[model samples]
Target: MASDHVAEFEAHRPRLFAVGYRLLGSAAEAEDLVQETFLRWNDADRDVVRTPAAWLTKVLTNLCLNRLASARSRREDYVGIWLPEPVMTDDSALGPLETAERRESVSLAMLVLMEKLTPVERAVFVLREAFGYRHREIAEILDITESNSQQVLRRAQAHLRERPRFDASGDQRRRIAELFLDAARGGDLPALERLLADDVVSSADGGGVAGAARNAIRGASRVARYFAGLLDVPLPGLELRVVELNGQPGILAVVGDALVSVTVVEVGDERVRRIYNVVNPDKLRFLAAQCGLVARNWRQVIEDTSGSVMELRAARFRE
Candidate 1:
C-alpha cells in the first residue's frame, strides 16, 4: 500500500510542479510545494481522497495562492524589474505551447502580467487557462462557488487581454534571436531598429547585486539603442547560449562562475515586441547549476569595472 501510494503521487508530480511554477514563477518553490503535497498525501486516507490528481491540484494551487499574496508586497520593493526566474523547459514542462493560447500562459511576459492579478484571480487564471480545469472543478478546489470561479477567471482574462500574444514558432524565434544578436554585436542600429516593434519595451532585472537599469526602458528607438549601447559596452567574461526558457527560445548568459543574465523576447509578426532581461542572482541559481557554475555575486570582484554594462561581457552564443 505504501509503495502504491508513492507511485500514485509521483504520477501527478509534473502537473503539480507546473501549477506551482506558473503560479509562483520559482522552480525551487514549486519543488518545495510538490514535497509538501506529497507529505500531505502520505497522510491522506487513500480511499476517501478518491481522486489523487484533483486533491493534489487543489493543495498545490492553494499553496501557491498563499505564497503569491505574500510575494506581491516584496516585489513592490524589489531592487529592479523582477522577471521570472528563467527555467530551461519544454512542452512537457509547460504543456503544448504550439498554440498562442497555450504558449501565452507560460510565457515570461504573461507570467509578469499575472503579477498584476489578485491571488484568487491568479489561481483562477492558471487553473482555467493553463490546466484546462472546468469552472465547477476549480470552484470545488478553491472552495468557491462555481459561478464565482467563472467570474474571477473572466476578470483575469480581461486584464490579460491586452498583453502581446507569442505567435512565433521555434524556428522563427531562433532565427529572429540570431539576427537580433548579430545586429547588436555588429552595432548595426538600422538592422535592430527594423526588427523591433514601434512600442517595444525592454526590462532589466539585475536585483541590485548586478548592475542594471533601475527602471524599464520603452519605445522602439530607445530599446534598439539600448541593446546597441549594451553591445558597445559589454561586460567581461560573459558567455551566451541559446536555451528554451519558459517554453520559448531565449538567450542565457554566464559570467565566470555566475549566471549573469537571461533575455527572453516576445515576437509578433516576426518582430520583437518585448524583451525581458533577468539578472537577479537569486533567480539564476538553477541556470548556473545547469551550466556547472555557482550563482553568486561576482559584482564585488569587479566593482570598479567601467565602460561596460555590468549585465554581461563579450558573449559566446551556443545553440
Candidate 2:
C-alpha cells in the first residue's frame, strides 16, 4: 500500500515540479520544495487524499508563498541585480508554452515582474492565470474565500498591467532577434540603432561575482552602445549559439567549453524593446548542462576580460 502511494505521487512528480518551478524561479529551490512535498505525501494517509494532485498543489503553493515572502528581504541586500536562473525549458517542464499567453507566463520578463506581486497575489496569479485553476479551486488551495480569490486575482492583474510586459509574438520576436544579434555581433552602430526602439532598456545580472552593468542602460543609442562595446572586445575562443530560451529566441555565448552568458531580448514594432543579459556564472549551470559543456573557469573566463566590459562584470556571485 505504501509503495502504491509512492508510485501515485511519482506519477504526478512532473506536474509538481512545474508548479514549484513556475512559482519559484530557481530550479534548485523548486526541487527542494518538491522533495519536501513528497515527504509529506508519504506520511499522509492515502484514504484521506481524495484528490492527490490538488492536495499536493495546495501544499506546494503554500511552501512557495512562504519562501517568496522570506526571499523578498534577502533580495533587497543582494549584491548588484538578481535575475531568475535562466532555464533551458521544455514542454513538460513548465507546460505547453504553445500560445503567447502561456509562453509569456514563464518568460524571464514575467518572472521578474512577479516580484511586485504580494505573496497572496502571486499565489492567486500563478494558480488562476497560469494553471487555469478556478476561483473556487484556488480558494480551497489558498484557504481563502472564493470572493477573496477573485479580488486578489483582479488586483494581481491590475498591478501587472501597470507594469508593461512585452507582448510581441514568437514570430515577431524571432525576426527582430536574428537582426538584433547580427548588429550586436559585429558592433554595428548604425545597424544597432536601426534595430533598437527609441526607449530601449538594457539590464544585466552579474550577481556581483561577475562584471555587469550596475545600473540599467536606457534609450536606444545607449542600449546600442552597450552591446556594441561588449562585442568589440572578443574573448579568446568565444562561440555564439542561437537557441530558444523560455519560448523566445536567445543567444548563448560559450568560450571553449564554458558558458559565458545567455542573452534574451524583448522586441516590438520591428525594434528591440529590452535586452536582458545574464552573465552571472552561478546561474549558467543549466545552460552549460544543456549545451553539453561546463561553466567557464573563473581564471580562464577572465583572461581576455581584463580592462574590458567583462572585467566590470566579474562581480562576486551573491548567494
Taking all chains together, the TM-score of candidate 2 against the true structure is: 0.89
How far in Å is the alpha carbon of 172 misplaced in model 2?
A: 3.4
Write candidate 2's Cα lDDT for 246-268 as tens digits. Answer: 76678888876788888988776
Q: RMSD for each model, in Å, please? A: 4.3, 4.9
- Local error of candidate 2 at 79, Å? 1.5
Regions of candidate 2 where Cα sits further than 4 Å from its true position? 1-3, 90-92, 163-168, 297-300, 304-319
The sequence of per-residue lDDT tens digits that candidate 1 reaches over residues 1-319 is 7999999899888878888988998877888988998999998877789888888998888888888888889988888788888777753665556666667778888888988899999999988888789999999999999999999988998898776676678889878888888887788889999999898889988887777888889988888888887656446676777777776778876666666677887788899988988767788886676667777554553454443233434333311
In terms of TM-score, the best-performing candidate is 2
Q: Which residue pairs come into collision in candidate 1?
A: 235-312, 235-313
TM-score of each: 0.89, 0.89
